[model samples]
Target: MQHLDDSTRTELEAAAFRRLLHHLDEHKEVQNIELMILADFCRNCLSKWLVAAAEERGETLDYETAREYVYGMPYSEWKSLYQAEATPEQQAAFEARQAAKQEKGQ
Candidate 1:
């Protein structure tokens, strides 16, 4: 990667991101709370990152549009179809993970 040209690196990164979105789309049962507990990020976080990235490039990306891209549909539609209420265990795990991050001054 150190030897790769900037354009090539960017292309590879973009491809990887697309693959990640596809993968997440395929795994809709893996809810956002599980992602937050395990990885500290989720689909909404990806949408926010995209919005921030577009802003950095002097572009305006609406959050809902980014979310639609990431979710493969309008978020409201996706939520109605697939999103689940967080189980008590999942909520506890997510809170513990946040506490750990706080302890590390993240």
Candidate 2:
């Protein structure tokens, strides 16, 4: 990373991020809750980060556009295609992880 110029490194990083979003979008059957449980990040988080990065550079990236970028289409379409309600056990496990994360931060 230190050896590469900032622009090159940034381009590589953005490309990698795009690839990840593409993979996730292609596998829409994988729910955000599952991503959060497994990787501690979700599509929403990725979208938010994209928007934040754009804003940091004085670019005007709105939420919907960012979400579409992350989803590889409109979010509603993605949700309709693959989103599902989590089971109680899944919800409980997520809550437990959240609690543990918060505890660690303290």
Best by TM-score: 1
Candidate 2 per-residue C-alpha lDDT over 1-106 given as tens digits, one digit per residue, 9 for 90 to 100: 9999999998999899889977986787888998888889899999999899989999999999999988888999888877899989879989988999999993
List RMSD in Å for every model shown: 0.6, 1.3
**Clashing pairs in model 2, backbone N/Cα/C closer than 3 A:** none
For candidate 1, give the lDDT of residue 44: 100
Residue 55, model 1: lDDT of: 100
lDDT of 1 by residue, 1-106 (tens): 9899999999999999999999999999999999999999999999999999999999999999999999999999999999999999999999999999999999
TM-score of 2: 0.91
Model 1, residue pairs in steric clash: none
Per-residue lDDT for 44 in model 2?
Answer: 94
C-alpha TM-scores of all predictions: 0.98, 0.91
Model 1 deviation from native, Cα RMSD in Å: 0.6
Scored by CA lDDT, what does every candidate get? 0.97, 0.89
